[model samples]
Target: MRFLVITLIVHRPDPVTGITPSARDRLREVVDSAVLAEELGFDGFGVGERHERPFISSSPPVVLSHLAARTSRIRLFTAVTTLSLLDPVRAYEDYATLDNLSDGRLELIIGKGNGTAQRELFNVTPEDQWDRNAESYELFRQIWRQDTITAQPRYRPALHEAEVWPRPYQQPIRVWHGSATSRESVDLAARYGDPLFSANVTNPIEPYAELVHYYRQRWAEYGHDPALAAVGAGTAGFHVAPRSQDAVAAYAPVFAGQLAFQRSMGMEPVFPTLEDFIERSSALIGSPQQIIDKVHRYHEQFGHSVLHLHAEAGGLPPAEHRASLELFQSEVAPALRRTIPDPPWPWAPVLPEAAVTAAAD
Candidate 1:
């Protein structure tokens, strides 16, 4: 299985102790954690975008470009580029430039973002977001693949033939549809023969598993190879210690803070308690064995080759976060990798020039 590190860049006041990181510190920590993810053998590192209070990753492309310069091998991704809220031409030009800089190692996951904050910020209606997402993606895809294209849409003017330049390193960088409780995203992925990444963070597995099944069924119906239908799954949280109790004790405060923040925002708490949260939700907080078991169970439901884990959220202390990541890489990752083969990503395997030179050194 391919392991990916996903970040929300959330910083919430401590529900129990009332402590939170400064905005500057939170941004620095995100970059530090992304660098560490590479050192720890994660295949990909992605940052989520949010245009609201408590979230600092509103500009993922800038952050990812910085990460690209700092790290050599790991693939970089935007967890979900809010395509609906963006101008398609600009988004294509910027990310295609990033793809060239990253040497064919960029994956774009597009979505209609959750929450009303972004919609209000961009003056988009929730009902119209899907239409915007579809139109923007169609144009973006053409911009990547075709040298010249003529297109007209509600938001864009007619183009006789416009060529978007600094074309991507890859002929067309892969796109994964980010689905959060939407059949529209699933159908879009199926229609385009792109992959689907389910947001299983805030909910249980049944709902998402059904979506994956729907995607596969539709993919086959669309005359694509069912085996080529790639699906990626997301988890809520992760904290693996030497013992289960220690893991819970270490992560509970942060989890509690997150739950409280969610409730304060008038969003329903997905779990009743921390214990219940880890058990039912995709929060993988436990010992190595327990984590391994839970991931395997999710694999059965998701049947996905890539499993993304959110180990750092709500601004957990940096040191504690590093320790949790270390334990996962040292103890949990090897066992999981041994049990499952890596996912098929055509752009995943090229070695960076630095690695080649280092071997000579």
Candidate 2:
């Protein structure tokens, strides 16, 4: 299985210690984590976008551009770029520039995004967000494929064979649709034969598994190859130690912090207690063997070849968090990598000889 480390750049005070890093420090941590992920040999590192309070990931392109400069070979990803709230033309321009800056190592995961504050901030409503997402993606894909395209869209001004500057470095970059119990996103992903990435952090396996199955079903209906349908899944959290008890004990405060943060936000959590959270949620907190077993269980349901772990050092101490990640690479990853089949990585384009000559001339 291919593994990615992702962070949403949540800027909240530590629930356990009542300490919050300065915004600058918080962002520095994210950059540092991406570097660490590369050092630890992760396949990719992703940053999420959220235009709301407590989340400073409003500009993933800027953040990813920096990450691209810091590391080579590790694929850079947007955990879920908020297409519904963005102008497709602008979005494509930023990512295209980033793709060039990253040496064509950029991949995208697009979603409508959530949260009332962010939706309000972007002037996107639940009723029309899906339509906006679909429309934006249609235009965005056209921009990526064609040199110039004429088009009209409801959410943005019409394009009359408009050519966006700094053409893509990659002929076509891979885009994964991010879904969370949303058939609109799933159907869109299947219709286009793009990969589906399940936001599996919230609830149990049943909902996510059902969505994955439906994505596969739709993939067949759309005349796409069943073998080409790729899926990736996200985890609620990640912490591992030599012993299950030790891992659980260390993660308990983190769990408590999560519940506190939820309640503080006036949202009730599905798992009120740490034990329930571990029992049902996708959080990987246990010994290495137990973590591997849990992943196998999840893989049986989702058939996802890609898995993402949280990159930030949430409530855990920096030393322990680093140790857990190191241990995972040393132990858990090898075992899972041996058994789980991975989806094909995105193709990096090679310029034609004619194009190379034209550029030189």
Which ranges in model 1 have alpha carbons more than 4 Å from their true place? Answer: 14-17, 311-316, 347-361
Relative to the unseen true structure, what is the C-alpha lDDT of residue 128 in candidate 2, on a scale of 0 to 100?
Answer: 98
Q: Per-residue alpha-carbon lDDT of model 1 for 143-167, expressed as tens digits? A: 8888898998887787779887876
What digit string (tens of lDDT, one per residue) describes model 2 on residues 120-159?
9888888999999999999999999899999978989999
Report the CA-based lDDT of candidate 1 relative to the real structure: 0.84
**Compared to the true structure, candidate 2 yields what TM-score?**
0.96
Error of 2 at 91 (Å): 0.3
* Alpha carbon lDDT at 71, candidate 2: 91
List clashing residue pairs in candidate 1: none
Q: Which residue runs does candidate 2 get wrong by more than 4 Å?
A: 345-361
Model 1, TM vs. native: 0.92
